[model samples]
Target: MWVADYLSLLITCQAMSQSDMEGVEQCFLDISVDQVLHYDGVPAVEPWATMYIDAIHDKRFGDAIWARYQIFGDVVDGLIDDGRLTVLESIEEDAVGYKKNAPEAFDEAVAFYKSVTNSADGHPEVIEIIMRIDKEDVSNRYFPEGG
Candidate 1:
């Protein structure tokens, strides 16, 4: 079921002729931050969050690291305000891990996230995770780019 949704995301992107995979951004926005966390299989399924950031051209994999960054500020706020995490926890503790594909993309996303929101000043925990590269413990899926 999850794989189908993941594939659907890809097919939707392809059908829309999104070469750079802009569909990821749109899809994440469509799915909503709350929905993303509701899925227990997100860690096992949403493995592409950063799985293929390096070879942006074609590497058999893609994820919405960019959009995640866009919405992470809110995610952080919600989690922290709810007392789920402390002000010292990192993104790695959020239970969601990107495949660490393109660390730079994560960086750029963090920059964008911070620029638009007060997340940086609101909570250090949010800042710690959103800005983290988190290349240490992440799964990298190698799905065929054109497959």
Candidate 2:
């Protein structure tokens, strides 16, 4: 089980850009080890979290990435629940399928992020972190090779 966890973490790190790795690292540092190991909803100390922290702190990764990993799901779910599917759809259009246009999609995403940040219960800090992410950081993850 440990090996499997490590391997998955390795794969995730390998796939991430240097900045994203740093963000992951910061997240680990900000969160306690106990939180990672025993969070109620999710095991925060899983492979992805561990690999990110190790890569940035131990491996000396880049520093451009913002810490957004922790709140990613919450942001997405909030958007969906709020019926802001246009934001998600725009991102998908840019990231994949027939309308794969990074600039436009990124612009829309940014706008949506800004809106979220300004609204009540927006979790400004989390939105701020996510706002720092750019199209290049996520495009490859969402879109298949040559897609």
Estimate every model's Cα lDDT from 0 to 1: 0.37, 0.39
Q: Deviation in angstroms for 65 in model 1?
A: 13
Model 1, poorest ten-residue lDDT window? 54-63
The Cα RMSD in angstroms, rounded to one decimal, for candidate 1 relative to the true structure is 14.3
What TM-score do all the candidates reach, one by one? 0.26, 0.23
lDDT of 2 by residue, 1-147 (tens): 999999977875565554432222221133432333335444453444554345334432211112223222333443432344433343343334322344555455456445432233322443343345543355454544432
Clashes of 2: 1
Clashing pairs in 2: 36-45
The TM-score of predicted model 2 comes to 0.23
| Best by the lDDT measure | 2
Highest TM-score: give the candidate number.
1
TM-score of 1: 0.26
Model 1 over residues 1-147: C-alpha lDDT tens digits?
A: 999999977764554333443322231122322234344333313332332232122322112332243333434553442455433332444322332554555555555545543322323444445555343444543333222
Model 1 Cα shift for residue 85 (angstroms): 9.8
lDDT at 70, model 1 = 30
